[model samples]
Structure formats: C-alpha cells, structure tokens
Target: MARFRLLPDEQLARSPLRELWREFARQHSAMAGLALFLLFVVLAVLSPLLAPHDPYLQNDALLLIAPSWSEAGLVQYPFGTDDLGRDLLSRMLIGARYSFGIALITVLGALLTGLVLGSLAGMSKGLKSSALNHVLDLALTIPSLLLAIIIVAILGPGLINTIWAIMLALLPQFVHSVRNAIAEQLNLDYVIAYRLDGASNWQVLTRVILPNIWERLTVTASMALSTAILDIAALGFLGLGAQAPTAEWGAIIADSLDLIYVAPVGVALPGLLIFTCVLSVNLVGDGLRNAMKKRRDN
Candidate 1:
C-alpha cells in the first residue's frame, strides 16, 4: 500500500529559508534574473582583478577611441575610451558596485526605517494615526523622482547626498505598504485568535503577521531595489550625484552625449546595462508575486 505524506507547515519548517528557496526556484524567470544579478555582482567584485586598465587613468592617444573590434580601435581598449580617454570597460565594471551597493543599502535602510514607522502607525489609533496617514497621502502625491530631486537639492549634490535622497524618496512607499498590510492582517481571524489567546500586539506581529507577509515584503524590496538603482543613475546623470570623473552609468551616458550620434554604442551600451538590470529585478519581483499567489491558492 502506498503511503500518503504531508508537506511540512511552512512556518513550522526547520528550514523555512530552504523552503523559500525551493519556492523561488519554481519560477524560471526568477532564477534567470538571480543569475544575471549575480553576474553583475561578480563583475563588480572582480573588477580590480579582471579589468585590464585603470578605470580613471587617461591616455591622450586613445581619445574618442572606438571599441577594440572597430577598425580604428586598439586591441588594448576592448570597450574603448570615454571622452576623457579613460577605459570604458573598466569604468563600467567599477560602476556596477556603485549602483548595486548603494541601492542595496538604500533598500535595506528604507525597509527597516519604514517598517518601524509602519508598525507604529498600524498599531496606533485616533487623531495621530489619521494625521500620519494624511501625511503619507500628501507625500505620495509628489513624484518620487521629484521628491528625490528636492531632497538632493537641499542636501547639496554629492554621492552621500544622492543616497540619502533616494532613500527618503523610497520611504513613503515602504511605509505605506507595510502599514496597509499590517492593518489588513490585524483584522484577520488568525490575528484575532492570537490576540484572544493572550498574545501581545508585538508577539502577534512577530509570530503571526510578519511571517505571513514576509513574501510580500521581499517582493516589494526587490522592486524597490530596481527603482533605487535607476534613481542613482538618474541623479548621477543630472550632475547632482557621483560628480565628475565618477564611472556611474548615468554619468557615463552624460559624458558621451555629444558623441551619441557619431558613436551611438558608447551611449547605448550603458543605457542597455541599466535596462537589463532593472528588467531582471522586475522579473524576479513578478515571480515572487506569482509564487506567493500560488502558495495562497494551494
């Protein structure tokens, strides 16, 4: 006789991370996105070892040089030189760290700070909660990019300021999402049961609510990361971030705008890198949404 086996309850599983990994792996697109993201991380990590030339070093002879494959280009400069004659390939490899590293930090900062604010808002009552919600509504009315610009303008243009600007711009989204999700979950039967069983609000949140909403938070974080990365590049392009001689992708594009018509690839390649990274992240986020939906359906 064949024996029937039951899957372990997700929350009770000894290795919930392993279970999540299995769920995450169910989506091929997510796996692909992860692979692409990892490739960028690796390239950034190994840039010093792998890059043939100094990213910031200039050679007057290599001015406006084409990629190595082009007839006019030298074999040494595989991705050619920028307007300043610095190695584009090396710059690109180095720039990956800025986007990925800063965005990761921004997302984590926004998540933690927003989570604290959201939890407080979700638990609070009366006029103060209403006032806070209204503030969030007002904040959301402004475009995030515009909000970021305003913050950057006040803070003055620089690398650190850009990070703070992006983080501030992203906070409202996380705060709103967490607040709404927690509020909704609080009214659910399981949450009420926990309360009736003498669980404190904090315990219910930690033991019951957060575990269920973990997937939603992760998906949001993934989406937020892509936005942060794009914003970093955009601010860099606008001369309000990263500054001159920095190899940031957006700044790289800005540097080559004059030659866009004459050497289109120089401009196009950086844009493509941004596009690919953003798309990969969005796909992963979408996959997480799908996985969460599937889990709920089952």
Candidate 2:
C-alpha cells in the first residue's frame, strides 16, 4: 500500500511545446495580443460576406460624409465615405484582406528562401560559409524599407513585384539568424555525441541541430511578420504595391491624403489599424522570447 514506482523516462521528459505554451499563456499582454490578431484575421477572412457595400463603388452624392455620430455624419455611412464616395468601412474590411494576405505571403516566401540559404551556410565551413556570411552582411547594411523601395523601383510598380521586393528585403535577417543558430549548435555536446554514434552529417544537421534551432527560428518569424506588414504598407503608400480600386490600407490612405482636412477619419483609420496590427505581432514575439528565456532558465 505504501510502495511507489518511478515514472518512465519517456513520461518524465517534458513537452517543450506544452511548456512554451504554458509560459506564453502566463503573459496577459501576449494573450490580449493574440486575441486582437485573431479578430483581425477573422475580419479579413469574412470581409466579402460582412462588408455592407462594394469597396470600389462610387456615388458623388455620398462623397466625404463624416463618420456616423459626428455632427455632420450620416448613419448610412458609419465610417463615412471617401472623396470618391466609396464606403470607408467596406474598403477597410477588404483592405485587411489585402494587407494581411500580402504580409503572410511575403513572410512565408522570405522564411523559405532564408531557411534554404541559411542551412547551406550553416552546414558549410571555411570559405563557403564566409562568403555567404559576407553577402548577408552586405544586405543588412541597407535599410530594409529602402532596399524594398529600390527593388520595387527596379522591377516596376505592381502587386507581385512589391511582394517579391518585401520578401527579398526580409530574407537576410532570417538567413543570419538560422546560420548563427546552426553554427552554435554544431559545437554542442549532443552534436558531438551524435557524430560519435555514427550519425551522418546530414542527420546531425537535420535531425539534431534543426530541432534545437526551431524555437529561435519561430521567434524570428514572428518578429519578421510585423516588419513584412510595415514594408508592404510602405510600398503600397508609395504607389508601388497595390494599385487603385484594390482596397489596400496604404493605398486607401494615399488616395485620401488630399481629403485630410475634409475627411480626417479616412486617413486616420487605416493608419490606426496598421499600428494596432504591428503592435499585436510585436507583443506576441516578445512573449515567445520571454517564454523561451524562462524555459531555458528552468
């Protein structure tokens, strides 16, 4: 009745993902951020069904109406109408789809490209790794937005070109992070043990090193999302990304700039949404970083 048995080694081993999630949930700010982010994602996904009017439709009679509840506003145009008389609320909902969709796509592209390049550099030695490192350093020397702008300018203004430009601008940071993580893991005792156990170089890199480095990469990816969104918006604002009638947030702001005094909300609303999205993403990244740090300490 008093005898007890020890748990199996497998059962004793903690789940890293579960542990990380526990830590993440302990952070109130991070939970709030995650909720806000999910709300926007749902809004973006449901835009077509939920939007009250055609984002691109024009009616001269309804132009420049203030948001409902404003002294001069109309209930029919809750967020008001732009100079072209397009419904601002409807345009913004659709813009969420464009803005967030492009950001997600660009981040994914950058992550894939970076993982391939970085893995190669990380696995290599001497001159080869050095050359890759040098290239990354050179790319890092330029500001990301400026580099994106230059790339967009060279490729000519359009949606696909802008996505490529943003992806290219983001690629170097991921490459650098992954490369460093792999190189550091190579010197660890577990890697040496795996090699002594007759593990192939490929196995050591893929099975041993990659799994250990995934947390770092995840953190990098989360942070890069915010950067990707900002870069996309910047390109759109400069008329190099999404074009007219597309309902992208930055394009919306750009089109409404001349009407700032006449319809300030038209400009402010998009900018606020962009700010909120970026802030939420950054908060989530910060939470992950903190969670990882705590896990390591434990």
Candidate 3:
C-alpha cells in the first residue's frame, strides 16, 4: 500500500485559508465575536447533557417563578420558569440548538441554490442572463422578512415550511451578489489570461474566479446568517415556526409576552440571546469585509 504524505510547512503557511485565518485573528472584535458564537455552538451541542430539566416538562406550582435569589425564586430553577412552568434555562439551551441549527440549514440551502443560478447567469450570453437578472431583481424588491412571511403563509405554518420559506426569501440576494462578482471577474486580466492559455470557461470559473471571489461569498454568508436567525425568530414569534411545546427562542419570547410584567426575565432572556447572536454575527461580517479590503489593497 502507498503511504500518504502531508504538505510541507512552507506550502501550508502559504495556503489561502491559513492566510485568511491570520488576518481574521488580528481583528480583536472579530475574534471576540467568533468566541461568543463558538460558545453558543458549544451550549447548543451540550444542551441535552447540560440542561438540568426536560425542556417540555411543566410544573403548574412553579409557574412564572423568578430567577433564583429573588424572594419567590427556587434554587433548582435558577433562571426561573415560563408561564407553563418549563425551566427557563433548559428551554433557552434547547432553543439555542433550534435557532442556530435552523439558521445554518437555511443559509446553506440558499447558498447552494444561489451559487448555481448565479454562476449560470454570470456565464450566459444574452437573453437567458437578462431574464434571470430580471427575475432576481423582482424578487429583491420585496423585503426578505415580508417575502418570508408571504411564503410561510402560502405554505402553511410549520417548522419545515418556515425553513423553506426563509431559504427562498434569502436566495435572490445571494444570486445577485454572486452573479455580479462573477460577471466582474469575467473581464479581468486573470480570466483573459486563463482563456488565452486554452482553459475552458468552466475551468476558469471553477479554478480561478471562484477562488478569487470566495472571500466576498464568505462575508455574504456571515451577513446572511444574522438575517436568517432574525427572520426565523420572527416567524416563530408569529406562531408560524417551531410550534408550541418546542423550545425555540422566539417562540419562548412570544409565549411570555402576556406575562412580561409579571416575569420580565422570562421574556428578556431569550430576546437577549437572539440579540447577542445576531450582533456577534454582524460584527464578524463587518470584520471580514474590512480584512478583505486590506488584503486586496496589499
């Protein structure tokens, strides 16, 4: 049997991803955001083992309990209880998994669909590209949240439907961004050189243009992550996503609204989680954009 060999250290140091990581690491805000995001991921992954109580189990006697240390609070329910008496900490942990998982799935679906359509649009000659652009523009005119709501309404309310709805709503933005990037690259010296060297259109696109535009795509994806999280949460808030008995962050907040005055912490905790997650993602996206700009300048 033949033995496999790893790349030499010098070659590894020159890798684009390694270079990108070095750049990303230098941005303190970006590193902080990454840390916070990773913490959420860890919490989500370990929720089953870490959460003290079953998220669904309710105790009527403990309904609307306050956080521990409050006069009426119990030590066992540190973060308090929801209206139905579900443990707030446990529900929030499980909600982290649901919210992040759904957002990631939706973004990935949109990214794949967009890349395919956008590449085709960018490479096409005349009429096909024009038609695709027109359709994408029409889709872009509507706000993504509104479009998502319309889709969810049409599809009927449910978790899977909300995912599909958000994915479709986010698709146009990715298509527009990728198509423009590819179209711009098509006229560049590198692309012309590749063509002159007898490289096929697909080869130039896959091996050259795609690599050059990857940084932009990553920034776009990060921004889309925040948007997807917010949109999914909005859908859940409206009772159109991750239906009752499921521990989704938005659903938790929505369910606690009527008791906001009575148990403000119950409503605030989940909302705080949503805000922190979205803010961190946006910060990371901004940091990436700045880093890419500096890289191009150098």
Candidate 4:
C-alpha cells in the first residue's frame, strides 16, 4: 500500500488553515498532546452521564477508601472516595468542566481585549502610545498568578470571579505581544504598499495585518489557556477560588490533603490532570511556533 502526505505548496498554496493542520500534524508530540486535550474535553462534556456517582454525594462508610486495585477498595468507586466520602472520579470529571470553561473564556476574553487595545497602542503616536506602553509595562511586572490573585482579592472569590481574574491577568501579555507584532507588521513593505494603495487603517488591519499575524495570536492564546488553568487551580488551592463542593480540581486536592499519606492517589490524581492539561497546551503551542517558522511571510 502507498502512503500519501501533504507537502507545503509554494505557488499554488493550500488554504491557510489546511496548510497549518498539515504542518501541525508533522509533530508527534503535538498530535499526542491534541489527543490528550480532546480526551479531557470529551470527558468534561460527558461528565454527567459518565460519572458513576453524584459528584457531591457523600457516603459516610466509604471515607478514605483506596483505589479499586487496593484490597479493601470498593468496585463501585473506581478511583475510591475522598476523605469527605465523595467519589474521586466523579469529582474529577465534574472539575474538568470548570477547567475547560476557564481556558476558553479566559483565552477569548483576553484575546479580544488585547486586539482592541493593542491596535490602538500600535497605531497611535507620541504621548498616547508611550503612556499605553508604560502602563502595560507596569502591569506586566506583576506575574500573571499574582495579578490574578490581586483581582480575585478585590472581586472576591468564586468561579466567575476566577475566570475574570485570569482574563484580566492575561490581558497585559496579549496586549504587549500584539502591540509588538502590529508595530512590526506596520513597518513591513507590504503594509506600506497597502497604505499607499489607499487602504484604510481598518481595511489594512482586517485584510492583511490580522491574517498575517494569526500564527502569533494562536500561540499567545495557547499560552494563555495553560496559564488560566494553572491560575484557577492555584487560586482554588489557596482557598480563594471556587468554594467547597464545587469539584474544582484544586479544591478537590485541598479537601483531600489530610489523606495524602493514607490516600496519596486522591491528591495525585487531580494534580496529574492539571499537569497533563498544561503540558498538552505547551506542546501544542511549541508545535504551532515551529510550524509558523516554516511558513513563508504573507
């Protein structure tokens, strides 16, 4: 049997998205990361049906039960029960929903905010641009997690507040990155040609600048998603986000902390999910960056 593969087309190039997929698929790590990412997403979506027991349901007798592989462990609770007697697997499935929600909402919100503000900063001149840059510089000095904590402190903690905090914390990074990218693109010969050909600022931005810089935006979004996941988990771990019984991964681990020695698997499972989620996003981002490098300038 013969095998076929896509090669980057020079003159008659494929559609931009299709070409990107071909490039992305070339990386084995990226493909595996994508698979793992999708698996989590599916689990999150189907949590209600897939979960054997109600996530919040507590069985007084099942407290601190080890995993099913353990001799005293019960078959009904595959991952066993937490100290609170809640099913670990059910809680994790439910928690994944919040994680994915935070990722998507935070990424989109930050991206939109960054685009509008960064474009203004990029296009403006003199004092306006200087002031915007200076403010962003100050904001960036605070790490994303710290910035998120500050916002959450003021807003008060909950799932919604956590989402907003992560989005705001991520905003400065996207703004700076976008501003730099836009500034660089503006000085390029093609952009100048567009300006000379009577393209309005909006037209140039929508038609040329954005299309050319999508790779940068996508990579930034990937990074933001991973950061958002970590921030949500950290905030929960710190007792500042997603209150008890919500099944958020970090809070789940917090509830099971006392059981770390008697039931290490409970704490480790949520941590493992968080680790894998962040790892998958980083791998995908790295793949996109490498693929973008191979792409010819638009």
In terms of TM-score, the best-performing candidate is: 2
Query: Weakest 10 consecutive residues, lDDT, candidate 2?
Result: 5-14
Worst 10 residues of 3 by lDDT: 10-19
lDDT of 1 by residue, 129-210 (tens): 9999999989989877889999999999999999999999999988898999999999999899989999998899899988
Candidate 3, residues 1-298: lDDT per residue as tens digits?
9987777755545676765676778899999998888888788788899999999998989888889989989999999998888899999999988888789889999998999989998989799899999999999999999999999999999999999999999999999999999999999997999899999989988999898888888889998999999998999999998899889988888888999999999789999999999988987898888777765675
- Summing lDDT over every window of 10 consecutive residues in candidate 4, give the lowest-scoring window: 5-14
TM-score of 4: 0.93
Name the runs in model 2 displaced over 4 angstroms: 1-13
What is candidate 2's lDDT per residue for 106-157, written digit by digit as tens? Answer: 8888898898899999989899889889999999999889999999999999
Per-residue lDDT of candidate 4, residues 44-162 (tens digit) = 78888998899998889888888899898889988989887889889999998887666777889999999999989887889989999999999999999999999999999898899
Please report, in order, the local distance difference test score of every candidate based on alpha carbons: 0.85, 0.89, 0.89, 0.88
- State how far residue 109 of model 3 sits from its true place (Å): 1.1
lDDT of 2 at 297: 89
TM-scores of the candidates in the order shown = 0.92, 0.94, 0.93, 0.93
- For every candidate structure, what is the RMSD over all alpha carbons to the true structure, in angstroms? 2.9, 2.5, 3.9, 4.0
Candidate 2, pairs of clashing residues:
none
TM-score (C-alpha, index-matched) for candidate 2: 0.94
Q: Tell me the lDDT of candidate 4.
A: 0.88
